[model samples]
Target chain A: MAPTTQTPPSLRPSPATLAITRIVLIAAAVLFLAPVYWLIVSSTKSNPDLISSNGLLFAGNNIVENYTALMSWTQGNFWRWVGNSMLYSTVAGVLGTLVSVSAGYALAKFRMPGKAGIQLAILGGLLMPIALLTVPLYIFFNGLGLTNTIWAVIIPSCVSPFGVFLGRMFVDAGVPDELLEASRLDGSGEVRTFFTLVLRLLAPAMVTIFLFIFVATWNNFLLPLMMLNSAELKPVTLGLYGMMSYFSPQYGAVLQGALLSVIPLVVLFFVLQRYWQSGLTAGAVKG
Target chain B: MSTLTRPTAPERLVTEQRAQANRRRRRREGRIGWGFFAPFAILFVLTFVIPILVSIRSSFFTEKAAGDSLYGGGGMVETFAFLDNYAQVLGNATFWEGMGRVLLFGAFQIPVMLGGALILALLLDSFIVRRVAFFRLSYFLPYAIPGVIAALVWTYIFSPGLSPINQTLGSISEWLTGLLGNNVDLTIDFFAPGTIIASMATMTTWTFMGYNMLIFLAALQAIPHDLYEAARLDGAGEFDIVRRIKVPMVGQATLLAVLLSIIGTVQLFNEPTVLAAVNPWMGNDYTPMMLAYSSMMGTTSPSGAGPASAVSISMAVIAGILAAIFALVQKRSTR
Candidate 1:
């Protein structure tokens, strides 16, 4: 570690290379962000200005009008869809995170038979793409009289095998054997210890898993497209797709809807990104 | 206690009691462990496992009509279909075409996306790029945006009349043409049937490049600094260290990402489905996933349950095979 601190002068990339790297990175950033920047700018323009005006710059301050149009155009269905999105994402994300994390903690700490089999089943589910099962799920839900209901979306989403895997990784890494033993030795009941120590230890991982599941459920399209037939029940992604798929979409309104849909996600990302980024990297490598 | 190298009878009894208590404790803990695991287990089985089983079963059994011919039937009778659904799917040109397009899309796309991600990750890790936070934020911003919205925005951006992309490209090419004294036709239509794959690839690359980059970056960042020192001491240069140590270290991660991407790409629906709104010629069976979905939607035939399941089963099988092959190769290479 001491020798590496010096980082041999030869190991240092030349100034020319650094400049080149900077230039390349900046160029890539500009290109990469063009569409995203366009989305923000273009959503604020009138339909005519959107096409005729310079694509990079905003011509008119039409964000309010576009938003108004979106509200009126969808008959406030967009707001309902957004609500539904929040509902589904939050419920499933929170539920699945709690369940999986607890299961993971138990698996990590307890002496349980068939834990290996359960883990393998989870792995098998991960390998088999869930998107491919949407059709059959649609039929299955139909049989259970759950189709077009929130359950159709929420129930399936409540089991993220990946989240379980991550939770286990976090438990094994974060919660030491000695700590649990000490807690037990202190006469802390199993449930009490779990709530006080294990839950506290697993907080970051739980949040990470929740956010992952939230984003996944929020962005989910295929499952909803299959099961959701009612317009009022549609999540934002499905709602937006419906708007776009119409014969003649109201471009201005749809743009506003799209913009509205991503705002919360983006803000959440910015706020919690640092917390999850480290957790995620650790889990990604270890898992 | 004093003579023999063995415990007395009381000690043995005490040990037996301890073992029994341990067993009881383990049994209690095991019950609690299962209690914790039960929700995920039940939900997983109800959703994932059951769906696969149902699909397989439905694929193998066809609904038998009353009078054996009439459209109107009595109570539903399901007869053993055997390979009838498989035969239907395999013989269908549309399904094959969709399969072909998906394979073709993945063949080119998986490499380029993963390669771009690898390069970006390496660049970020190299410490040459300034404002790493800014790049990380910008690149990862797309991931936060829902796929439907991203595709919608990209679709608008890809629109012929309204597309900033083509408008920008035309000007760039004109400048290039003037500089090089040659014709440069960089104005390719994204919605055109021929270049639709390119557009899809670009959109996918846009959405995932940063994501995969972060994953690769995680792997790269995990490399021990001492390993770098050791390599340098052995006269390994920057490129050698990067290639031999860094790349190989991240090889498992890259393979994992590739496998995940393979699973993802084959199940491509959102982008292409949206794009088909512009170009209708991609047809109902745009990709194998589309074929399965389209059949289930029953746009062509009424209740294409059997065939949709067949396509679903076939796709899962094909993907399983491809994933297995990739896993085998990676294992062999790593070994």
Candidate 2:
């Protein structure tokens, strides 16, 4: 049988069908890009312009003001949130990727006892709903006195079983066994071989894993909402959420803040778009 | 065959044996690949596995009020509650109501979202769509934007006071007011309670459809080309081929997407919570996750942590049971 998600390639489309497909595809693209367009346009407009002008179209002469307002809105606190998000996502991304890559290598290449069990454990981890664990995680953090700290968010995020699972699959399929054997014959240590030979082969998968974890950790909400309280320690997600809760009526400021928060992510996505798509699927194959 | 010849041969044999031993040592060292996985194993046990065990245990305890204390207090000491929290959760009218809504949302939203994704995926996979990568990235870009930001963006789009939808209505009303030469209004309000569910659905589908599409597309691409050639030789129509071949081929991915949707809908919080902030009618307990959040964080539950814990444990159990039931049904059907 053909793969379900693929197109039925046998049916020759009439000219009308072809035209309709193009239109629909264009429409979908427009729909997808519309919100982003609105974000940028709104961010550029002044408070009054934002309130009065067409939200979908560009208005002149308010970009500087919006930047200043966003920067100064919380007594110069927006950057703090940005920094916090960066610190959390960066640390979690690197460590999570490392763990995933190495773990995946072992699971894919090694003949350790309990390998099947570990693989099953990773599957269970993926299926376990975040909501189910949120409350328990909170209480656990409370016991550790790690609540309201960046580590609470960073540390927990580092243990992504899915990442490790992805790392293992990529290494298994992408890296060659012969290369490792050659390196071993040269008398290099296993660690050195991995760092030198296996890592070079697994670079694409690693980048993909890093981007996935970074986006997840950066955009994460409920965990940070449950964990951190001090604004300085708040990642952008939590900071924006807190602002939404406290300043529900300040549309202009909130709008501006929301726009600012999304820019970096959007830029990151565009830069690393290919990795996310390919990496996500490869990780998802077993499921 | 003299004594000198015997000594040289013995020395050569010793050298050969040492080289052989070194080779064996190297092979063992290289083969013991567990070194690479050590960090992940330690972390997985510490953060992921251990916390789950802790959660199961903590679910049994009742928290004390007036401080950050749980258990060991008057009227708050946790005992062998023995499914009491689960009982309370199942019995709680509000909890069930929230769960029912989630179920309803799941039933309707999953198909719509997946169908939309499938259509898009199929369309993209076809030779008709040009700039394929661009469209793919565009569709998937929203998933990249954090949930909080997605929620925020939708919040603006749906907000009555500031939304373009409402603003356009107001503009039309003003135009009517001028044309009629009388004080008349022609705007239709969308913030009504009845339409809020649809509003939330629109937001979620936008955020997730692309993600589902990517998975479906990947699965689609993995299918071999000869299947299509064979179908063509049989003169199967496009729609027929889709129903018979493509759908079945992507069945595993479709099932996974459904499972994920079910779980996600049950824990629906971010969208509704953000909406509630902008729209007063949504209130604190609009969704079960919201209810749990309020119980734990809101002022009414100064001692609400325990009840919140109870509510969450119940929710988890329900999710578990439902998942089990689903897996069973799927297994039977496949068999």
Clashing residue pairs in all predictions, respectively, total 0, 5
Candidate 2 residue pairs that clash: A4-B246, A4-B249, A4-B250, A6-B220, A104-A168
DockQ of 1: 0.61
Model 2 TM-score relative to the real fold: 0.87
Off by over 4 Å in 2: A1-12, B1-33, B64-80, B169-188, B298-306, B331-335
- The models' CA-based lDDT, in order, is 0.84, 0.77
**lDDT tens digits, residues A150-233, model 1?**
999999888888888888888998999899899999999887888899989989889889998899999889999989899899
N/CA/C clash count, model 2: 5
Residue runs of model 1 more than 4 Å from their true location after superposition: A1-8, A185-187, B1-15, B64-69, B74-76, B171-186
- Fnat by candidate, in order: 0.68, 0.58
TM-score of each: 0.94, 0.87
Pairs in clash, predicted candidate 1:
none
Model 1 compared with the native: what TM-score?
0.94
Chain A alone, model 1, TM-score? Answer: 0.92
Please state every model's RMSD to the true fold in angstroms: 2.7, 6.0
Candidate maximizing lDDT:
1
